[model samples]
Target: MRVAIVGAGLMGAQIGCEYALGGHEVRLHARDLRRAQQRVDEGFALVDRHALFTADEVRAAAARVSTAADPGDAASGADLLVESLPEDLELKTAVLRAALAEAPEAHVATNTSSLSIAAIGEAIGSPERTVGTHYLNPPLLMPPVEVIGGERTAPETVELARKTLIALGKLPVVVRRDVPGFVWNRLQFALVRECAWLVEHGVASAEDVDVVMREGLARRWRRVGPLRAVALGGIDTWNRSGRGIVPDLSNARELPDLATVAITEGNVSDDAGARDAALARELREERALGAAR
Candidate 1:
C-alpha cells in the first residue's frame, strides 16, 4: 500500500510511521521536509525504545518513509491520501482538492479532531471519496481509530478504510452517524466538562480529579469499560443515582474558563519534552499490560 500523508507534524508523522511499520510505503509531505523526516525518525526511535518491534523491523520501517515537497508529490500514485493538517476547513479543502487531483482514484481520509466530514466533502466537491478518520493523539499507541463516513460517502470507501486501518493493526470503529467529535472526543469532553465544573465550584482540585481518574475510573474502565462497569455495578442503582446527578452536571454552552485559568493561575507544565517522555512511559506500560492479558 502506498500512503500519502499531508502535514508531517505530530499526528501526521506518527500516523505515517504506523503505516510504514505496517509494511506500507509512506510519503510525508510538508513545507519543512527536513523537520518532517526528523519527526519520522523520532517516531521510529520511540517504537524501538518501547521494543514494540525488533531492531531490524524498526530499521526497515524507518527506511520505508520518505519526504515529499508538496501534496501532489506525496499523493502521486498513492492508494490513500490522509490530510493531517490544521483544523481549518478552507485550508484542508484546498489541500485535498490539489492532492486528490493528483491521485483521483485514491481514498481520502481527513484527520480532523472536531470537524464535519460532510461539510469538508461539500467544500472539496468529492463527497463520495471523503471520510473522517479521527486518529487519537499518539496514533501508534492508540488502537481505536474512528472511521466516519459522510452522507454521500460510498459504502465501498468506508469498507476500504476499515480494511486498511485493520491492516495497520488498529481497531476501526465505524460511526454510523456523522456527529461532531465522533465517539472518543464526545465521551472525553463530557467527562472533562464535569471535571472542570467540579473545579470551578470548589468541589475538587484538578489534582484530585486526576487522582480519581488515574486511581479509580481509568483502572476500572480498563478492566470492564464504562458500559460494562456500570452493568457490573447494577444499572438500576446507576439509573436512580443519575436522576439527581445528571441534572446537576455542567451544561455550559460557551467554552469553560477552567483551562484558561489553569494555564494562567495554576502551575501547569509547559515542558513538552518531559510530558512526551512521561506519556511514552505510560504507553509502554499500557502495551505491556495488554500483552499480558
Candidate 2:
C-alpha cells in the first residue's frame, strides 16, 4: 500500500517509518523541507534503537519514504492518507480539506488525540472517507492503535483502516462511537485527576503515589483492567473496599493550590524517556521474535 503521512512531526514520522518497515511505500508531507528531514532523521534513530533493522536495512526502508512540500504532492496516488497535524480544529480542517481535494479516492485517517472525529470529518467535506486512527505517541513502538469512527464514518473505512493497521503489525481496536479523548486519554485523565487530588489533600507524596501505582496497580493493569481486577478480588471484597473509599472534592475549590504550582514547576514524576526507551526495546524484541517465526 502507498501511505501518505501529513505533518512530519514525531507521530507522523513514526507512523511513516512503521509503514515503511512493513514494506509499504510511504510519503511524508510537511510544510517545510527541514522539518520533514528532521522527522526522517528521528524516525531512523528510533528504528536503529529498536534494532528492528541494521543501518543498511533502515536506509533501504527509507528509500521507500519520500518527502513532499504540499498536501497535493503527498496525497497523489496515496492509498491511505493519514493526518497527524496539530490538535487544533481549524488547522486540521484546512489540511484535511486540501488532502481530500488532492486524493479523493484515498482513505483518510486522523491522529487526533482528543478532538471529535465528527467535527474533523465535517471539515474535510467527506466524512465517510475520514476516520480517527489515533496512535499513542511514538507510533513505531506502540502496539495498539485506536480506530475510531465518527457519526458519518463508513463501515468500509473502519475495516480498511483496521486491515491497514494490521499490515503494519499493530493491534487495531475499533471504537464504534466518537468520544472525547477516546478510551486511553479518558482512563489516564481519570487516574491523573485523582492523583492530583490526593497530592492536594496531602494524602501521599508524588513519588510515593507513583511508586504505589507502578509497583502495584500498573502490573495488575497490564494483565487486567480495573473493573476486572476488582471482580477477581471477589465481589464482597470489592464491595468492602468500595465502601471504605471516600469521594474527593469534585469542585474547583477542592483543588490543592500547591498541586498546580508543583506541576507548573515540572515536578511531575513521569519517566517519559525511560518509558519510551523501554517500549522501544520491547517492540524491537517483538519484531525479532516475529522474524524468527
Candidate 3:
C-alpha cells in the first residue's frame, strides 16, 4: 500500500512509521520543507528509542518511509491519503480538499479530534471518500483506532478502513453514527468532568482520586469492562445503580479554557503530562495482565 500522510507533525509521523513498518510505503508530506524534515528526524529518533521493535526492524521501516514537499507530491500516487494536520476546522477542510483532490481514487481519512466529518466532506466535495479516523495519541502503543463515516460515506469506505487498520495490526472500532466527541472522548470526558467537579467541591484530593482510578476502578474495568462488569450482576441491579449514580455525575454545561489558566496558575501542564504518562503506562501493564489471564 502507498500511504500519503498530509502532515509532518508527531501524530502524522508516528502513523507513517507504523504503516511503513507494517510493510507499506509511506510519504510524510508538509508544505514547509524544514518542518517535514524535522518531523522525519523526530520520528526516526523515536524508532531508535523505542524498546518494542528491534534495530533491523526499525531500519527496514525507516527505509520504506520517504518525505514529500507538498500535498500533491504525496497524494499523486497514494492508495490511502490521511489528513493529520492541526485540529482547526478551516485548516483541515482546506488540506483535505487539496490532498483528496490530487488523488480522486484514493481512500480519504482525517485525524480530527472534534470537527464534524460531514461538514468537512461538504467542504471537500467528496462526501463518499471522507471518513473520521481518530487514532489515539502515541498511536503505536495506544489501541482502538476509531473508524467513523460521514452520513454520505459509502459502506465500502468503512470496510476498507477496517481492513486496512486490521492489516496494520490495529484495533478499529466503528462508530456507527456521526456524533461529536465520538465514543472515546465522550466516555473519557464524562469521567473527567465528574473528577474535576469532585476536586472542586473538596470531596477528594487530586492524589486520592488517582488512587481510586488506579487501585479501584481500573482493576475492575480491566477484567470485565464497565458494561460487562455491570451486566455481571444482571440488568435490574445495573439499572438501579445507574438511576442513583447517573444523576449524581457532573452536570456542568460549560467548560473553562484552562490552557492559559493552567500555565499561569502553575506548572499544571507538566503535572498533567507526568500524570498522563503514569496512567498510560499503567493501562499497558494492565492490558498485559489481562492477556496473561
Candidate 4:
C-alpha cells in the first residue's frame, strides 16, 4: 500500500515510519521543506536504532519517502491518507478539505485526539470515506489505534481502516459512535480532572499521587478497568468506599472555560513536547536493539 502522511511533526513521522516498517511504501508531506527534511532525517535515525533497517536499509526505506509542498501533489497516488495536523477544528477542516479534493480515491483518516469525526467528515464533503484513526502519542510504540466511525461514516470504510491499520502492525479498537473526545480522552480527562482537583486541594503531593497510581493502581489497571478492579475488590467494599470519597473542588480554579484560553495561559503541561519526541526516539532504539538480539 502507498500511504501518504500529511504533516511531518512527531505523530506524522512516527506513523509514517511504522507503515514503512510494515513494508508499505510511505511518503511524508510537510508544508515546510526544512521541516520535511528534518523529519525524514529523524525518522531514519530512529528507525536505524531499532535496527529494523541498517543504515543502508534505512536509506533504502527512506528512499520511498518523498516530500511535497502542495497537498494535492502529496496525496497523489495514495491508497491511504493520514492527516496529523494540529488539534484545531478549523485547521483540520481546511487540511481535510484539501486532502479530500486531492486524493478523492484514497481512504481518509484523521489522527485527531478530541475533534468530532462527523464534523471533520462534513467539512471534507465525504463522510463515508472519512474515519478517525486516533493513535496515542508516539504512534510507532502505541499498539492501540481507536478506529472511530462518524454518524455518516460508512461501515465498509470503517472496516477498511481497521484492516489497513492491522496490516500496518497496529491494534485497532473500533468505536461505533463518534463522540467528541472519543473514549480515550473522555476516560483520561475524567481521571486527570480529578487529579487536578486533588492537586489544587493539596490532598496529596504530586509525587505521592503518582506513586499511588504507578505502584498501586497501575499494575492492576493493566488487566481491568477501574470499575472492574473495584468490583473484584468486593462490590460492597467499593460501594462503601465511594460513599464519602466525592472529590472536593472548592479550591479548584478554572484555568479557562475554553481550551484556547488554557493554552494561552500556559497551563498545559510542558512535558508533552519532550515526552513525545523522547518516546519516539526511545522506541526506535528499543526496536533496533531488539532486532539485533
lDDT digits (tens) for residues 122-212 of candidate 3: 7888889888898997776666799999999999999998888988767899999989889988888877777777767789866677789
> Top model by lDDT, which number?
1
RMSD of each: 2.7, 2.9, 3.6, 4.8
Q: For every model shown, what is its TM-score relative to the native structure?
A: 0.90, 0.89, 0.86, 0.81
lDDT of 2 by residue, 1-293 (tens): 88899888888988888888889999888988787878887888877876767889788888899998888888888888899999999998887778767788888899999999989888878788889999987787789999999999999999999998898789998887798889988777677767777676788887777778888999888789889987898989988777777444333434355446243444333556678778887777778898899
lDDT for predicted candidate 4 compared with the true structure: 0.76
Candidate 3 C-alpha error for residue 23, in Å: 1.2
Backbone clashes, candidate 4: 4
lDDT of each: 0.86, 0.83, 0.80, 0.76
- Which stretches of candidate 3 lie above 4 Å from their native place? 257-293
Residue ranges of candidate 4 with Cα displaced over 4 Å: 51-59, 247-293
Range of the 10 consecutive residues with the lowest summed lDDT in candidate 4: 254-263
Give the candidates in order of TM-score, highest first: 1, 2, 3, 4
lDDT of 4 by residue, 84-156 (tens): 9998888877776776677788888899998888888888888888899999875765678999989998999
> 228-257 in candidate 1: lDDT tens per residue?
878898999999999998888899875586
Estimate the TM-score for candidate 3.
Answer: 0.86
Ranking by lDDT: 1, 2, 3, 4
The CA-based lDDT of model 2 is what? 0.83
The residue-level lDDT of candidate 4 at 167 comes to 78
